[model samples]
Target: MERRPRRRLLLHGLVGLALLLADLPALASSLAAWRITRQGALELRTSPNVSLQAFFEAGTRLRGPRVWVDLPGAPSRTRSIRGSGDVREVRIGRPTPDTTRLVLEFRPGTELNPADLRLVGTAADRWRMDLRGLSRPVLLGLGEGDIEGSATVAYSPPAPFPTSGAPLSADGLPVVPRDRFKVVIDPGHGGPDPGAVGIGGLRETDVVLDVSLQVARLLQARGVQVVMTRTSEVDVDLPPRVALANRVGADVFVSVHANALSMARPDVNGIETFYFSSSSSRRLAGSLQGQMLAVSPGSPDRGVKAGRFFVIRRTVMPSALVEMGFVTGGLDSPRLANPAHRRRLALALAAGVLQYLGGR
Candidate 1:
């Protein structure tokens, strides 16, 4: 009887221990590292398990511009790092017991536009906040009326193309009016970022650059004002590219890139285009996808997709990102490598833009 009682007591103690373990909270995530890039952007690396929530707030004369990033379920901690240019300092603190916060402080008299500040990265743990290439004045005089005045800018629709005497391009598409329409062409990757490398040692940066240049020439010849994100070999971060388009008030923004897959799967190849929110962007993507498929009948039609890519999401104007074809694919590699085929592809893309503009 004494042995049975002891055995029951041991079983109850084991059950109590499991209940205690189950009631305990999970381990909190943390910031792994952080640094400022040469381009004057703040880059933060978080623990792989962290999910970030961030926002920017405009500052006044008393305080500086600030950006707050919250990491939930994290412990209280305080840290600071010096910043350059517009940013004066970066601080990490605990705003709440369960939330760790990161604050970016801008220099005094600096007026940061919320649109100009962007946080971009695809990964859950890696992010970059870029404030460079701000077209607005950094310093503004403080006035009593400034607080009451409306900051909204009136929207003006683009001037319609002249119905009569509109010259037609050799491809039978209507030419855009001279100096009336602007298009920003962004070649996806360049310089240090080689993008996708595929069959026969073909580089995505090289192919996209060539096609984008050709597209620019085609558009320029048709009297459309063309702006290229990169004209040569150089690394251009995502924020500046969007900033340029927004600053210039571009009518259309298109980022050109080649898709890639594993070399072992050469069968995966297609033309696809992506757009963020907005009906205009969706229509533009659809037009581009249709035109690309019309040119390369043999290539698979991947169709238009909705994506949250930074360039397309941040640009104020209608934007699309086009993936020409897979670099690793058996069929796409040879065509992308050929100069004449690239020209054909460029013509198709240009036609798509013209088609959209004309319809609009």
Candidate 2:
């Protein structure tokens, strides 16, 4: 057959070649906007929990409780189209019980024509929401409408949590009798995981790595053995980050990351340390929080909180996560961005490690 026009051919490829990895019957929801399937079975799924999955050909735009997908695929050249009504943001509460809706606000405009929207993946709640935006067919044109309006949708996901409780602190962590403990510092996010971006191209990974290395060097100078999750800018999944510390038989574990809140600047300030419920985690958070502030004077003290994060939650030893500063919002960004401030953060973290060992 003669080759179809370039644009048309590309559009047709949206369904994609059925691949071996794709479970044929499973339908994946697009994270962007509401979808109405025409032919073939569609499965809507969000990660860690499969929401909707079934085989179907014809489907209508069902206004559920919380989701917004881009208007049926649209032409590249089409800036705006006359939508019958307004479309809004989508919110997700839980995966097991998936609910989505559209929020629209209407204002008078001369022949309101809204731009065709496409769905982007969901934020966190696992890659499920993000994966929803993956596969979609193209809709090149739109019907008549001079619609002008806006809508907002909210998804409140049940707290994402894993199945098991964390290992208790120092109970049977293989901590040997030693002068100083072998501490492994894990700097969260690197490579592909930009973590969070800032005004000055400051990346979380680069900053944390620098701080981790500093902490390591400081500890080493004090006759304490030190190990780092990574020495270079590279991708390291969460699991492996902890494994490094475990592998090195580290006496304690510390995971470091800067916080970010773009939409709403958090009024909360200063350092907040987190530990798993396990006994080990508690001790670790206490130690880190105390010293992190000692080095960085005036650092906001959020105090130590407990939560199950992969690194600290699973570690067999005392573990804690240090939120050095809020990268976005409040006044934490400017200071965290300073090299002297970063060095102080490192030194304080190192000192915490020393203090924790001293406690025992």
Candidate models: Cα lDDT each: 0.67, 0.48
lDDT for residue 110 in candidate 2, whole number 0-100: 15
TM-score, every prediction: 0.55, 0.50
User: Which regions of candidate 2 fall more than 4 Å away from where they truly are?
Assistant: 1-180, 263-268
**Which predicted model would earn the best lDDT?**
1
Q: Per-residue alpha-carbon lDDT of model 2 for 1-360, expressed as tens digits?
A: 001111100001113111011111223322232322222111122222122211111112443122222211121222322232221221222222222212221212212111111121121111111212212322222222211112211111122211112211222122333555677777776544557765466677667877776766656556666665544443445655565566667788888888776636646457788988877678878888887777666667878998767787767787888888776645677777777778777767876777778767
Residue range 143-252, candidate 1, lDDT tens digits: 11122222211111122211112232436655666677889888876544568999999989888878777777777777787777665444445666777789778999
Error of 1 at 125 (Å): 31
Tell me the TM-score of model 2: 0.50
